[model samples]
Target: MPVLNPDIARAFDEIADLLEIEDANPFRVRAYRTAARLVLGLSSDLKTMVEAGEDLTELPGIGEDLAKKIIEIVTTGHCSFLEKLEKQTPPALTELLKVPGLGPKRVKALWHELDVETVDQLTRAAREGRIRSVPGFGEKTEARILEALQAQIAAVPRFPIAVAAPYAAALVRYLQNVPGVRRVVVAGSFRRGRDTVGDLDILATVAADSPIMERFTAYEDVAEVFSQGTTRATVILRNKLQVDLRAVDESAYGAALHYFTGSKSHNIAIRRMGQDMGLKVNEYGLFRGKERIAGDTEESVYAAVGLPYIEPELRENRGEIQAARAGHLPKLVAMGDLRGDLHAHSKASDGHHSMRDMAAAARAAGLEYLAITEHSRHLTIAHGLDPVRLRRQMDEIDALNTELDGITLLKGIEVDILEDGSLDLPDSILSDLELVVAAVHYRFDLPRGKQTARILKAMDSPHFTILAHPSGRLIGSREPMDVDMPRIIRHARERGCFLEINAQPERLDLVDIHARTAKEEGVLLAVNSDAHSIHDFDNLRFGLQQAQRGWLEMKDVLNTRTLKELRPLLAATMSR
Candidate 1:
């Protein structure tokens, strides 16, 4: 036996897998999902509770019986129930669970009738007009499947938000280094922290007489040039990624920045404002009464319009222009105000560092504290463990906590919320943990009502503290699971669950508009890095920028709390 600890959430996923197979009770399923999420966020071990024979009811949604199961897994490698469930179902179905709009029902249909079991097999069937014959599937649905397949093939692989973040930084780096380029920067949805960016947008200023355009087209990275012009260049680099670089004279830089760094709606509003002011706006320069005033930097452009510079998150034309004009712009949160980090990973699961190393890195970066939110049992591919491992990890965390002088390390699990609304682990294991970050993993396309009920049920647990990246959007890769955002925000507020502003470039799930709406509705937020490596810390600044654009403040975030204060918040949430 593998000595599974009841507290280790790694096995929670196995239970979720079992539930998906049995098509278990949605709310009960979400309990396991919640447990998985809660465990990843907590600093404690399930084995400790198992050893103490504790009840999971204190952890929320977890009763004494379920807690016993968690202990069973920790001391033994397998649970009899999960093992029995697995015997009746092919584990391979789990791999097919992620296709958009395709749920377990559809997967079962293709499996039982068509004997299709893989993406390639599904693709072939769709191409051959076989999928429509499956019950509940139509010609249109098959066509949609083919389209998604082709899109999947033609599209860039899903780069985690963390991976894409650096490309923007790299582009900026080059622009800053280029001669005559004085104010090079990244602008557009990427600047605003949209989950995915189309092509890179860079804005810069140069002396009117400078050969910046010529220098750019001939730059070392240039491979196949799409277009070469005086103001902009569109080129496909050796890596096959398209990059659009735009240049402007110093006098027109500011207006151009505002124009290019647009969510389109914000730009239209600005243009209207400019027209009212006897001016015009474009990616070139601002024309005011046929003559331009200040247009070199973003600062001058917003200032000219009688407004503070708008953050990128608010640049989506979502009342930001009116707010700026009315002088009702909410005070934006700053990067400096963030005092802690709420999510991170380590070698204990799929992360790259040790617990001590991750904590030390957080401390070195001047963070007040951080959470060691590793993957729970449901993420077996990521090496999610059972309760025994979770308990041992807690011991390591406790020891490290004592070693730190000022920085406090938190126990947190990035638990997987099963399709049925249950969490990955049992309740007995959850009550003693500090933080729970409930997340969605499988069955993303359930009916909206079902999905909503699923998450809401997870939140019923007092142990549930934060809703982590609720939408599960991987920018440029997938759309958010269908759910009513307003209602979701409202629920979080009522339940005291903090909505996350995930700092991953691709998964800045709660951007300004969402964050602002959340803030306006009294939702507490914690801007988290979801950092998997030490270098991922840089992504925090960008995430915070988007949070500021949402008009969040230090007080709205959990990471801003000192350890002493944060402990109470966690305690209170558990008690609730």
Candidate 2:
């Protein structure tokens, strides 16, 4: 199988993690980390680039040595250097880092002091009070680790939707190329646009005598085939993502797709509705007393239940069926509905691309305007802007705006909201920008009441235009801070400010539930890409899906308005 960009990136990350655990050279460790980020952020496939004989060294942050490693990974589907390092280090140490609050230092400490090399060992130590005995760990730390371990044990391993995308696309394309395949669709949480997917459910229609099952099992990426039959198969990919494929007759394609693409609760609800209508719904077809009625298309399936087609994203049984019946279903916001992106970054801060490059990329992405919201002085790691630097960048944007035609750049700052609810930058400086995207970057573990007040106070600032990633959660890596989301949503409405659905795959904050609350409270949400690189604008697609899943319409999205329409609304928020 071809090594996809994500696969290559993961290998680099593992190497970095293992090296860090071994206390290897800081520069060497940093190089692999940077390379991993560069690969993940690239819009093109590294395998294709390698096949075209492109000079990988020409890519920023990738040197000759890394270039050779990329080639080896792409051509052979494995990295010799990573394998050697894994042999040297306790490979499980890398997995230990996945525990929240456990970094390389702690992993190393645990391994050396407690002889703990695995989660199971660590869990046993924590439970036995051995973890607190480690020099740096205390009773509270040990308690938190134990709690995290319990949650981890109970949770099913799932990949972020973005992480699963390339694999699914590759598999679907492969299946579609099968000689006898007539139709191919991936269903389940993936089709529903869930934040993370536990597994892939694929449905296909093939001609009689097709050898699709054989071809699927023989695919290069298949690490193991658990089961195989004439019409169905299950396999685990090399990356450990499980996949189940079902080959259905052309007449039953829709029924199979609907059946497999489901939240079990949603499917049960539909089946109950079918039962009331004197109908039977199954993977084969929707029937009335054994006479097949509707199964040719999803639309027909919905029609059989006397309802209009419900989008996969709305099939979570979250009042969508009722809305569909009443003809009140929202016209979910589409990617094309956005005219401007109100949150983005440039190289002036932590972003990778220059202002001009980011502006050009946004224009190419069909955006009429893009906000350059660089980080402020509080975020030193990002080389965030001080007043002097911000002013210089604003002047630069003014010059670039004069030269640009298709796109306009809005001056903005992602100012930090301090623990005391004060803005990182003074109002004098923040007032100069077209937007102020306030964010909470530290103290994520504040008491619920304090956290809620902190955000509410920040929103009280006249210059606060939007709260970026309101929940401050990193999907899998970090849990959201304890805060009153309903109160925050209500405060935003009263304060005439907005919240953001930050589009970074790992930081898809303002999750669907909060987004729905914001929409219901008459508070518009900005589905911003939070783009750090030019290619990062692509993340807006995921943001749109998040918004759609929240039942947001174009009207509920702040950026869907024309730039002319947006300016007044923004100005109103910044007014005293």
Determine which window of 10 residues in candidate 1 has minimal summed lDDT. Answer: 1-10
- Steric clashes per prediction: 48, 1
Q: 1-576 in candidate 2: lDDT tens per residue? A: 679988988999999999899888977887898788778767778899999999988676689999999999999888999999989988988889999989899999999999999999999999899999999999999999999989899999999888888899899999999998988889999999999999999999999889999999998999999999999999999989999999999888888888898878888899999999999999888999979999988888889998898888888989999999999999989999999899988878877778898899899899999999999999987788999999999999999999998999999999999999999998888888899999999999899999999999999997999999999998778899999999999999999899999988888888998899999999999999898777788889889889999999999999999999999999998877
Tens-digit per-residue lDDT, 175-288, candidate 1: 676677777777776677655556667777776666767766675556788998888888764434567888777777777777887888778877777778887777666767
Among these predictions, the greatest lDDT belongs to 2
For each candidate, the alpha-carbon lDDT, in order, equals: 0.73, 0.91
Question: What value does the lDDT take at residue 168 in candidate 1?
Answer: 53
- Sequence-dependent TM-score of model 2: 0.97
- RMSD per candidate (Å) reads 12.9, 1.5
